[model samples]
Target: MAGLRARLKKTIVLVGMMGAGKTAVGKALAARLAVPFLDSDREIVKAASATIAEIFVRDGEAFFRDRETEVITRLLNAQASVLSTGGGAFLAAHNRQVISDAGVAVWLQADLDLLWSRVRHKNTRPLLRTANPRETLAELYKTRDPLYALADLRVSCGADYSIDDMATAVLEVLKSRPDVLEISRDG
Candidate 1:
């Protein structure tokens, strides 16, 4: 893994739904790769001095999304590491273009049921604060899966997979992309 860390040339951008374990698996993946772990949402919160939910309410989704793009672009340009993006961040064409140009986007694919199970109890998700949150999640799953498919690579997440397991899966996927990650045979 140390050799793998040395060979990493691009940032691994995790793009997926809120409950897709981007943050959790990203942290583990970064640890495994011995690189920094950055979250776009966390950066946004830091810059705004408010939570994502508050940002959406105070500034509006469009405003929040603009900030998200700026943060992502800045982070991707800085260093090679693992970056977890907000669910809707990849939906924007400009954001996708920037991510493709600067890093490798890896979609953490999970089914609606699995996503719902993971995020149902979370109050931090601003988009899931609807009257029918499950249905809303399903709708988001339907609409966003196609855009997510545009990612450079995809790693499926299952109910049986732990965070570390998912991180390993992402690492395996990264191994296939030589431009993004290179694995030394002597390691």
Candidate 2:
């Protein structure tokens, strides 16, 4: 793991649906690799002095997305770390390109049922504030899965996996991508 940490060559960006454990797994991954953990949503909220739900309500999604891109670009340029992005961030072509250029995007793929189980009670999700949130999430899952498939790598997420387990899974995937994460023999 220390060899993996010392040899990391690019940022590992986590992309997937809302309940895919990006934030949780990202934190663990960063810790295990001795790198920083950055959440684009948290960066946006910090910069705007508001929550994501408030940003969506006030500035609208387009505005927030623009800011998201800016933050992503800024963070990716700073250092190689684990970045957990908003569910919609990877859907943008420009964002995808930038991420591909600067880091490796890893989709934390989760099934609809598991996603729903994890996110159904989370009122913080702006997009799920509709009258029929389950239907909304289902529609989103259907629409976004194809785009999320464009990631550089993917790790299937299951209900049985803990945060550490998911992080370890992502780390294993990263190890397979020598261009993104290098494992030194000496460590």
Candidate 3:
């Protein structure tokens, strides 16, 4: 797939755990396809003029989620780009519907251990600010796995997969459906 031009006809919305590398992989995927990259979390922060943690602390998770849903809708309506969503965004049924209708939802599945190793040092995740964050993440994983499984595509994430590697993996999977992805010569 190297040096091939891939067209993302519909948005490629990444869904999964926080440490599953959605942002990194999304950027790589967008760059590889020569399309715009958008992160739903970043868009929410920009719209609210505050960090996600600050929004949660000031308003609440519900308010923040409302803003998340709105941002997802607005972005989907705005353009077809590589979009990385917050870990919890797909947990909302309405969000799932909106994404399903407008784009291909790819779940970047990673083991709990892998996810923990990636996010343990990060203070950016508000949901993991608890005293027992690993336990909380495990719980979230157990519940969200079923929902994430509802995605249009699934890519397993492991220590061996680099950001570009994951992006290529996504393209390989997309090969099955040319309606969603079309590849041509770079020049």
lDDT of 3 by residue, 104-142 (tens): 899999999999999999999999999999999999999
lDDT of model 2 at residue 130?
95
Check candidate 2 and list the clashing pairs. Answer: none
lDDT of 2: 0.94
Better of 1 and 2 by lDDT: 2
User: How much does candidate 1 score in TM-score?
Assistant: 0.96
Candidate 1 clashing pairs? none
The lDDT for every candidate, in the order shown, is: 0.93, 0.94, 0.93
How far residue 125's Cα lies from its native spot in candidate 1, in Å, is 0.8
Candidate 2, residue 19: Cα displacement in angstroms equals 0.4
TM-score, cand. 3 vs. native? 0.96
Candidate 3 segments whose C-alpha is farther than 4 A from its true place: 185-187
